[model samples]
Target: MSKDDLKEAEALGRDLMWILGLIMHSGPEDRQRIALAYNQAQELVASIPKDNGDARPRIVACFERSDTYKAADDVACAGWLLTGMQERVNERDLPDWRKLRKIINNTVKMLTPPKPTIH
Candidate 1:
């Protein structure tokens, strides 16, 4: 990624962290603010370039997965994921494209709730 791209990604990561923090601490009464921040974070995530390899996909996947539930745990998971993304960007050593995609696909299995079984 170019220097500008890196900077932008870093900024987005920071923004996401802040938004997630807000969501975690705010109560249900703040639903409107939470929703707005969530959408803004989604837009920020989408603005990240695909050329960044694992960075974008990993963030996107984790963010999407987090959106699956209204629970605090999922929000915390997203915060953790964003922290890792920021670290990778700061280190300038994102995972390879192929590996990151594989990881993202596998995350669905790991994070998804078990399907109900009908007798």
Candidate 2:
């Protein structure tokens, strides 16, 4: 979203403002999280669990050749990569970056509906 480092940082701030707003207003039933799925992909790079060898299958399982989500393969990895990156960056003593990640996770949580209470 940026033409250069400075522009990228500014653009990221602007984008974060909008994202934060959406998260606050979006109820769990909303599909708004899908819009930011690509950005969320950064999580995966750090999320390759030591026991989960060959993660491709897990990634591939989410993609489907369908009319509604033809681009799922590309966007589905956002959350995974974002989470992975967050872990790695935090390990490097970056508290501020971790704050941004908390916001992202909150957004995801907001997009998820509360489990039904068995009546």
Which ranges in model 2 have alpha carbons more than 4 Å from their true place?
Answer: 1-13, 26-95
Tens-digit lDDT string for candidate 1 (1-119): 56866565555545554545555565654534334444545466666665545565645554564555336544444433443344344434543434443443343233333579999
- Using Cα atoms with residue i matched to residue i, what is each candidate's TM-score against the true structure? 0.32, 0.38
Task: Rate residue 109 of model 1 by lDDT.
Answer: 32
lDDT by residue for model 2 over 61-87, one digit each (tens)?
Answer: 222211124355432233333343333
**Which regions of candidate 1 are displaced past 4 Å?**
36-119
Q: How good is model 1 by TM-score?
A: 0.32
Give, for candidate 1, the lowest lDDT window spanning 10 residues. 104-113
* lDDT, model 1: 0.47
